[model samples]
Target: MAMEASEIESLIRTGIPDAHVEITDLAGDGNHYAARVVAESFRGLPRVQQQRRVYEALGGRMGGVLHALQLTTAVPE
Candidate 1:
């Protein structure tokens, strides 16, 4: 099963409500995706921790519906 970009965005939004998210289909197929997320929730966290939070938001969908995700996470300026 492939995961659509919107699905990924939805999961992210569920975790961080006020997030600015951008999703791209890296391989044209929905299997591979890249997401850039900006949110205030990341302010008190480290970069790796921020990314882990996003990964956790996927809720074990990473290897199933979503094959791979290239993620960039950050706090808003």
Candidate 2:
């Protein structure tokens, strides 16, 4: 099953309440998406860690309901 953009946003927000998440359906299909997440909590984290946080928010849905995700993370300037 494919995951909805709103559901992806909701899950990220749930895990990172202070995050500013932008989710896009790259293929016009729910299976493919791109997400750019900005948060104060990510300020000092490494790139890998930042991505991990976002993945963690999904609660292990990366390969299940969600098929492909091009993720970007950053600390707000």
Query: Residue 56: error of model 2 in Å?
Result: 0.7
State model 2's lDDT. Answer: 0.96
lDDT of every predicted structure (CA atoms): 0.90, 0.96
- Stretches of candidate 1 off by over 4 Å are none
lDDT of 2 by residue, 1-77 (tens): 88899999999999999999999999997999999999999988999999999999999999888999999999999
List TM-score per model, in order.
Answer: 0.94, 0.97
lDDT of 1 at 18: 83
Residue range with the least summed lDDT across 10 consecutive positions in model 2: 57-66
**18-73 in candidate 1: lDDT tens per residue?**
88999999999888888999999899999999999898888989887789999999
For candidate 2, the per-residue lDDT at 29 reads: 78
